[model samples]
Target: MIELQFSPEVANARATGSPLVALESTIITHGMPYPQNVETARAVEAEIRAAGAVPATIAVIDGQILVGLTEDQLEALGQTTDVAKLSRADLAVCVASGGTGATTVAATMIVAHLAGIRVFATGGIGGVHRGWETSLDISADLLELAQTPVTVVAAGAKAILDIPATLEVLETNGVPVIAVGQDDMPAFWSRSSGLRAPLRLDTGAEIARAADTRLALGLPGGQLVANPIPEDAEIPRDVIEPVIAEALSLAQTQGVSGKDVTPFLLDRVFHATEGASLAANIALVLNNARLGAAIAIATTT
Candidate 1:
């Protein structure tokens, strides 16, 4: 049996039956640059704690699956070069090879479930990528959500993806896509995708109860809570859509594909928006962290 390495704070939380929220580590290792990456990670954790839950930032280091990260570990991870970007496919391989890896949404959900964590917070999820009809490139995150029992709070699938198709896939998989306080599905970095949500819930308690009902019914998976970015922080759909189109055009011209697609497109979007996208990303992540904590607390009580 594989043993999970829990940080002191997370260990204490688990021991005391306190609420815990799982955080993915790719935001630190791959989502942003070093100092900012570490800083944002700390800020997100702070948000979770302030909202009344302990944050467990999941990663794999030297063959151990760390359910939570210590401060030193978080800093080191942010600065580490050549860290493998792990997902469901590569996670076990990374651990078996004694390699360090940063967990993506799918890997984080898997780890969170293993750690008995019921909720995870992330900036956004991977979904059906554009040109998927040709490339057939879909994220393992969708499948993870269909099988793992940990509820995930994300702004939505990244706006760069085929949002409608992503929603369709989730529906086909029987995963609940719950929009928080809105009828419109949120796009990452933007408050509205313009697509109506399949399910809508107004509060953390509502979302938690839905998740519990699914488990009670022996449903295979968890719910996707599509929380919108704070209004002040959102880029506005009209503003971001054109920027995303230009970025997608550039990606096509450059032949970026597979696992490299998202980071490449995000980099282009970041530059095109003059770093506004990153700022919005940070905002949304913090927002999601707060909601995740709320859901965690709700699940326990």
Candidate 2:
């Protein structure tokens, strides 16, 4: 059996049959700098708690799968360097090697299902890279969603990805892409990606029902809840599009490829936008937390 550790808060929630939302830890270890990353993490957790759900932040440390982290663990993880960004490809290896790591969307979904938690909140899900035709650089997250039953709430695919190709993969895999509150799928920092969503859900209850219906039908995969960045926090598609292009160009010129491409692009965009991108990322994460909490509540009840 795999070793699993649950924080006190999460333990109590499970004991009492309370709603719980799963959160990925890469946002803390790999998304940004120390204090800000932990602060944003705490804030997102607070949002879930305030919305009447418990937050279980998943990670791996010293061969143990942590379904939720304690305050000290969170603080230490935020300050730790050289943490592996784990996905389906290396999650078990990291555990067996007794290495420290932060869970990516795919890893989080796997852990969430193992912990009996049905909903996960994230900043964005990784998907097909821009040149996927050649590189075949698709994220393991897409396949994870198609295999796990956990409902994921996110701002949508990272803005640096090819949204069209990502959508095609999701459709081909029979994953439902439900845009919340709009017909257009969200594009990470932007509210609209200029692509029509496969389905639009107006409320958390609607999303919850869809997830439940999928299970009732014995569907093999989960649903993607494309929650948009709040209007007040969005950078707007028009403004962010050019910035994304510049970042992509810089990545290409720098010869950044494979897993390194995303962080490189995101960092370049963060600099180009004078930190507005980070602010938008934080906002969208909190927004997703709220929706994930709502879905958790709906799913459990």
Candidate 3:
């Protein structure tokens, strides 16, 4: 049997049949630095609770899958070093090996489904990398969404990815990419990706209804709720485009590839942008969390 543990709050929420939203732990362990990471995580959980849903931040710690973490655990995770970045390919292996790790979007979706939580909030999803035609380095997140029965709320795919190819993959997989409250698809730190979204949802209730309808129709995959970052927090596409290109070029020059590409590029971009990217990232995550809670509440009701 898969070993799983739930904190008292999540356990009570489950017992009461209350709305619950799943959160990925990579944001805390790998996305940002300490103190700020822990603070942002707590703020996100509080946002969910304030919106009438329980937040379950999923992670694997010492062979056990933790569906929810206590405050101390969150702080500890932020301070811990060398935590494995657990994705669909290695999530089970991490569990079997009794390793400590942070769950990525795909891994979190799998665990959320197993725990009966249908709604998840995240900063952004990974997708087809730039120059994917040559590398074939598509993220497992797309495939996971194609089959998992959990709705994911995010700003959209990471801006560093090939947006057009990512959309095509989602279309081919029959996954609905619904842009929330907008006609344009969102870029992770920016509000517009320069392409139209496959679908658009105006409210949390509409998103919830679509998810329910899909299940009723026996659809195999989850919905991608492309919630836009708040206009006030967005960095604007034009402003960040050249910055991203510069960061990508730097990555190539520095020979950053595979798992190291993202973090390396992100660090370079963060420095190039004078910390604006990180600020925007935190803002979008909180925005997604609030919407995720609303959708979860609608789903449960």
TM-score, every prediction: 0.99, 0.98, 0.99
Q: Estimate, for each residue in 230-260, the C-alpha lDDT of model 2 and write its tens digit.
A: 9999998899889989988888888889879
Model 3 scores a TM of 0.99
True-structure Cα RMSD, model 2: 0.9
Query: Model 1 reaches what TM-score against the true structure?
Result: 0.99
Q: Give the Cα error of residue 266 in candidate 2, in Å.
A: 0.3
Q: Model 1 — which ten-residue stretch has the worst lDDT? A: 292-301
> lDDT of candidate 2 vs native?
0.93
Measured with C-alpha atoms, the lDDT of residue 16 in candidate 3 is 95
- Give residue 87's error in model 3 in angstroms: 0.4
User: Which 10 consecutive residues of model 3 have the lowest summed lDDT?
Assistant: 252-261
Residue 48 in candidate 1, Cα distance off native in Å? 0.7
Residue-level lDDT of model 1, residues 1-301, one tens digit each, is 8899999999999999999999999999899998999999999999999999999999999999998889899989999999999999999899999999999999999889888999999999999999999999999999999999989999999999999999999999999999999999999998899999999999999999998888899999889999999999999999989998999998899988899999999999999999999999999999999999999999953
Higher-lDDT candidate of 1 and 3: 1
- Where model 2 places Cα greater than 4 Å from the true spot, the runs are none
Clashes of each: 0, 0, 0
